[model samples]
Target: MSVLVVGASAAGLTTAEALRRKGFRGALTVLGAEYHPPYDRPPLSKQFLSGDWDEARTRLRPDNLLAALDAEFVLGDPAVSLSDHTVHTAAGRSLTADHVVIATGLQPRRLPGPPLEGVHVLRTLDDAAALRNALAADKRGGVVVVGDGVLGAEIAATVRKLGIAVTLAGPQAALMEAQLGAVVGGLLGELHAAEGVELRLGAAVEQLEGVDGWVSGVRLVGGEVLPADVVVVALGAVPATGWLEGSGLTLENGVVCDEYCRAADGVYAAGDVARWRHEDRLVRLENRTNATEQALCVAANIMGEHQPYRPVPYFWTDQFGTKLQVHGRPSADLTIAEGTIGERFVAHYRDAGRIVGVLGWNAPKQTRTHRMHLISGEGHR
Candidate 1:
C-alpha cells in the first residue's frame, strides 16, 4: 500500500514513523510546504528567539534516523487541493495514495492591514528568526506584544530577557486567564511584572502605529499607545485549510473527523488540522504533544486497529526559569491540593465537584501524582 502524508512537520513525520514502527512496509511519501526538515516548535519562542539554541538543535530527528525511515520527502511543495485519494500541489504535482493524511498544521492570524516591517507572528522558524533579528538589531526601542496567550507571554518574557523593554497588551484580566483561571493567571502576571515586563491587560489593541511601513507602536482601544520599534502579534492561529476548500471535507475551524481521526474512507487527518470527535464533543488540540499523540492514533486506525482517540488535554509553558504543566482542562473551581500558591504548588480544578484538571507551578513531581486523580476518577484529597 502507498501512503501520502501532506505536512513535513512533527505530526506528519511522527505519523510516518509510527506507521513504519507498526510494521507498514509500504511506499511512504511526506510532502512539506517548508524547505527545512521536521523540527520542534515550542523552543522557537524561547531558546530559538533568544539565540540560546541554533537551528540544528531544534531538529526533531537526526539525518540518520530520517534516512532509516526510508520515506520519500517532497519539500518546498505545498498541497493546493485534494480530490479523492490524489493531492494536487502548488508545484503542479499530483500524488495519489491508498491513504492520505492531512497534517498541514496552522497559519498565524495577522492584523488587518498591509504587511509592515518589524511586525511578526511566531508560528514558523522563519518567523522566530525574523523577530529575533528585529530585536537584536536594536535594544533601544520597546516591544509591544499583542495577545496574552501562551505564545504572547513567552515572547514577552524572552524579549525582556534580551534587555529590551516589553509591554504585554491583551483583553484578558490576567495573563492566560481564559486558560488557567484568574488566580493562577494573576500569579503569572505577577511573575512577568517581577521580571520587568509591563502588563497592559484588559484592553484590546485598536491598531498598529507605523512609520515608513515599519511598526512604531500598538494603539489600544482606550486611546493608550504603547510605543515600540518591534511588535509581535501572537493573536493565535487558524487551521491551514484554505487549500482544502473544494476538497469535500467538512471544514469548520478545522478538518472535521470521526472518533478514529478518519475524515473519510481511506483519508484521515492529524495534528492541529484535525478536529475529531472525542467522547461527546469535537475537539482540536494545537500543542506539540497532541500532534505526536494524535498522529499515533491516526496511524493505528490506518492500520485497521480501530480505536477512538480520547486524550486528556495537556500542555506546558516555560518562562523566567519557571515551568508550568497543565493536565486536563483548567476550570474556575480550583483548589490548592499541595504546596502554596505563592511558590511551588499543585492546584486541582473541578467541575461540579469532580476533579477534572491539575496545574503544577514549579511542582512537577506533585503534578504527576495529581494527574492520576484526573485519570482514575479520584477526587483531590
Candidate 2:
C-alpha cells in the first residue's frame, strides 16, 4: 500500500513517521509547499525571531532522519487536488496513492491594508527571517502589532526585547481572550505594560497609512492614528483547504473527520487541517500535541488497526521569561483554584468537582502532575 501525505508541516511529518514506525513498508511521499524543511513553528516567534536559534535548531526532523525513513520528499510542491486516489500538484505532477492524508496546516491571515513595506506576519521561516532583519537593522523604531492573540503578544514581547517601542492594538477587549480568560487577559495586559509595551485594546484598525511606500502608522476606526515605523499583523491562521473545495470531502472550518481521523474510506485528515468529533464535542485544535496524537491514530487506523484519537489539547507559550502551560479545555462553569508557592504557582479549573483544565506558570512539575490526573480521570483533590 502506498501513502501520500500533503503539507509537510507538523501533522504531515508526524503521520509519515508514525506510519513508518507502525511497520508500513509502502511507498511514502510528503509534499510541502514551503521550500525549506519542516521546522518547529512555535519557536519561530520567540527564539528564531529574537536571533537566539538558527533554522537547523528549529527543524523537526533532521536530514539524517528523512534519509533513514527512506521517504520521498517533494518540497516546494503543494497538492492542489486529490481525486480518485491521485494527488495533483501545482507543478503539473500527479502522484498516486492507496491512502491519502491531508495535513495542509494553515496560513497566516492578512490584514486589509495597503501593501506597505515593513508590514510583517510571523508564520513561516521566511516571515521570521524578514522580521528579524528589519528589527536588527533599526531596533529603535516604533513597532505596531495589530493582533492581541498569543502570537501577537509574543511578537510584541520580542520586539520590546530589541529596544524597540511597541504598541499592540487589537479588536479584542484583552489579550488572548480565546486562551486566557478575562482575568488572565487583564494580567497579560499588566505584564506587557510592565515591559514598556503600549496596549490599545478594544480598538479597531480601519487602514494602514504609509509615507513614500513605507508604513508610517495605522488609522483606527474612530479616526485616530497611531504612529508606527514597523507594523506586524499577528492575526491568526486560516486552514489551507482552499484547494480541496471541489474534492468532495467535508470541509467546514477545517476538514471534518471521525474519531480515527478518517474523513472517508481511504482518506484521512490530521493536525490543524482537521476538525474531528471528540466525545460529545466537535473541536478544531491547532496544537502540537493534538497533531502528534491525531497522526498516530490516523496511521494506526490506516494500517487496519482501530485507535480513537482523544486528546486533552495541550499548548504552551513562553513570554516575559514565563512559561504558560495549558492542558485540556477550561469549562465555562469552572471553579478556579489559584495560589502562589514560592516561585511556582498554578491556576486549576474544575467543573462539577472534576478538574478539567490547569494552567501552570513557572510550575513544570505541578503541571505534569495535573496533566497526569486529568488524563487519569481524577478530580481535584
Candidate 3:
C-alpha cells in the first residue's frame, strides 16, 4: 500500500512517522509547499523572529530520523489538486496512493490591499525571516499590529522586546478576548502596558496608509491614525483547502471528515485542513497540538484500527513575561476557580460541580495535572 501525505508540517510528518512506526511498510511520500523540511511553527513568532534560534534549530524532525523513515520528499511543490486516488502537484507529478492524508494546515490572512512593503503576516518561515530582515534594515520607526489574537499579541510582544515601539490594535474589547476571556485578557493588557507597548483595544483598521510606496501607518475606524514603519497584520488564518475544491470531498470550513478522520474510502485527513464530525457539529480546530493528535489518530485508523479523533483542544501563548496554557474549551458560564492573577496560578473552569477546562498562567505543573483530568474524562478533584 502507498500513502501520500500532503503539507509536510507537524501534522503530515507525524502521520507519516506514526504510520512507519506502526509497521506500515508501504511506499510513503510527503509533499510540502515550503522548500524547507518540517519545522516547528510556534517558535517562528518568538525565537525565530527574535533571532535567538536559527532556522536549523526549529526543525521538527532531525535529518537522522527523517532519513531512517525513507519517505520520498517533494519539497517546494504544493499539491494543486486531488482526485479519487491521485494527487497532482504543480511540479507535474501525479502520485497515486491507496490513502491520502491532507494536512495542508493554513495560510495567513492578509489585509485587503495590494502587497505593500513592510507589511507582514507571521505564518510561514519565509514570513518570519522577511519580517526580521525588514525590522533589522529599518530600525527607525514604530510598528502597528492590526490584530488582537494570540498571534498579534505575540508579535507585539516580540517587537517590543527588540526595543521597537509597537501599537496593538484590534476589534476586540480586550487582548486575546476570544481565547483568554475578559478577565485574563485584561490582565494581559496590563502586562503589555507594563512592557511599554501601546494598546488600541475595541478598534478596527480602516486602511493601511503608505508613504513613498512603503507602509507608513494604520488608519483606524474612528479617524485615528497610528504612524508606523512596519505593519504586521496578525489576523488569524484560513485553512488551505482551495486545492480540494471540486475534488468531490465535503469542504465546508475545512475538509469534512468522519469521526475517524476519513474523508472517503481510502482517503483520510488530519490537522487544520480536516474538520471532523463531532456530535452533530463539525469541530474544526487550528491548534498545533490538535494537528499532531489528529494526525496520529488518522494514521492508526488508516492501519485498520477504528478510533475516533476527539481532542481536548490545547494551546499556549508566551508574551510579556507570562506563559499561558489552556486545556479544553472554557465556557463563559463555567464556574471559575481563581488561584491568582498575573502570576503563578491556575484558573479552573467548572460546570455542574465538575472541572471542564483548565487555564494556567505560569503554573505549568499544576495545570498539566488538571489537563490530564480532561483527557481522562474525569472531573476536577
Candidate 4:
C-alpha cells in the first residue's frame, strides 16, 4: 500500500515516522510546501526570535533521519488537489496512494490594514527570522502586538527581553482566554505590567498608519493613537484547508474527521487542519500534543489497526521565565480555583464537582500526575 502525507509540519512528519515504526513497509511519500524540513514552532516566538536558536537547531529531525525512514520527500511542492486516490501538486505533479493524510496545519490570520512595512505575523520560520533580524538592529523602539493570544504574549515577552518597549493590544480581557481562566488572566496582566510591558485589553485597532510605507503607529477604534516603530500581528491562525474545498469531505472551520482521525474512506486528517469529535463536541486543537497524538492515531488506523483518538489535549507556553502547562479542556461552567505549592502550583477546573482540567505553572510532576488521572477518567471533580 502507498501512503501520501500532505504537509511537512509536526503532524505530517510524526505521522510518517509513526507509520514506519508500526512496520508499514509500503511506499510512503511526504509532500511539503516549505523548502525546509519540519521544525519545532513553539520555540520560534521565544528562543528563535531572541537569537538563542537557529533554524537547523530547531528541526524536528535531521536530514539523515528522514532518509533512513525510506520515505519519499517532496519538498517545496504543495498539494493543490485531492481527487479519488490521487494527490495533485501545485508543481503539476501527481501521486497516487492507497491512503492519504492531510496535515497542512494552519496559516496566520492577516488583518486588513495599511501596507505597513514593519508589520509581521509570527507563524512560519520566515516570520521569526524577519522579526529577529529587525529587532536585533533596533532594540530601542516600541513594538505593538495586536493580539493577546499565546503567540502575542510570547513575542511581547521576547521583545521586552531585548530592552525594547512593547505594547500589547487585544480585544479580549486577558491573554489566552480559551486556555487560561479570567483569574489567571488577571495574574498575567499584573505580570506583564511588572515586566515593563504595556497592556491594552479590550482595545480594538482602527488602522495601522505608515510613514514612507513603513509602520509608524496604530490608531485605536476609540480614536487613540499609539506610536510604534515595529508592529507584530499575532492574531492567531486558521486551518490551511482551502485546497480541500469541494472535496466531498465535511469542512466546518476545519476538515471534519471521526474519532479515529478518518475524514473519509481511505482518507485521514490530523493536526490543526483537522476537527474531530471529542467529548460529544467537534474540536480542533492547535497544539503539539494534539498533533502528535492524532498523527499516531491516523498511523495506527492506516496500518489496519484501529486506535481511537481520545486525547486529554495538553499544551505549554514559556514566557517571562514562567512555564504554563495545561491539560484537558475546561468548560465555561467549570468551577475554577487556584492553589500554590511553594512556587509550584495548579489551577483546578471542575465541572459538576469533578476536576475537568488542570493548569500547572512550574509544576511538571503534579501536571503529569493530574494528566494521568484525567486520562484514566478518575479525576473529574
What order do candidates take by lDDT, descending?
1, 3, 4, 2
lDDT of 3 by residue, 5-45 (tens): 99899999999999999999989999999999999999998
Select the stronger candidate by TM-score from 2 and 3: 3
Q: Per-residue lDDT for 1-381 in model 2, tens only?
A: 999999788888988999999899989999999999888888888999989999898999889998888799999988888786788999999989999999999889988855899899988899999999988876445889999998999999988887789999998888886786666677778888999999999898888999999988988889889898889988789988998988888999999988888888899999998998888867799878788888888989989998888877788888888788888765544333445632356766767767778878778787887677677877432
List, residue by residue over 1-381, the lDDT tens digit for candidate 1: 999999999999999999999999999999999999998899999999999999999999999999999999999999999999999999999999999999999999999987788888999898888888888886566899999999999999999898888999999999999788999999999999999999999999999988899888899998989998888999999999999998999999999999999999999999999999987789999898899999999999989999888888889999898899998888999999999896999999998889888999999999999899877866432
User: Per-residue lDDT for 280 in model 2?
Assistant: 80
The lowest-lDDT stretch of 10 consecutive residues in candidate 1 is 372-381
Cα distance off (Å), candidate 3, residue 338: 5.7
> What stretches of model 4 exceed 4 Å from their correct place?
139-141, 332-342, 379-381
- What value of lDDT does candidate 4 attain over all alpha carbons? 0.85
The per-residue C-alpha lDDT of model 3 at residue 318 equals: 92
Number of the candidate with higher lDDT, 1 or 2: 1
- For model 3, the stretches where C-alpha displacement exceeds 4 angstroms are 334-338, 351-354, 376-381
Highest TM-score: which candidate?
A: 1
TM-score of each: 0.98, 0.95, 0.96, 0.95
- Residue 49's C-alpha lDDT in candidate 1? 94
C-alpha RMSD for every candidate: 1.4, 2.1, 1.7, 1.9
What overall lDDT, based on C-alpha atoms, would model 1 receive against the true structure? 0.93
Model 4 lDDT at residue 84: 79
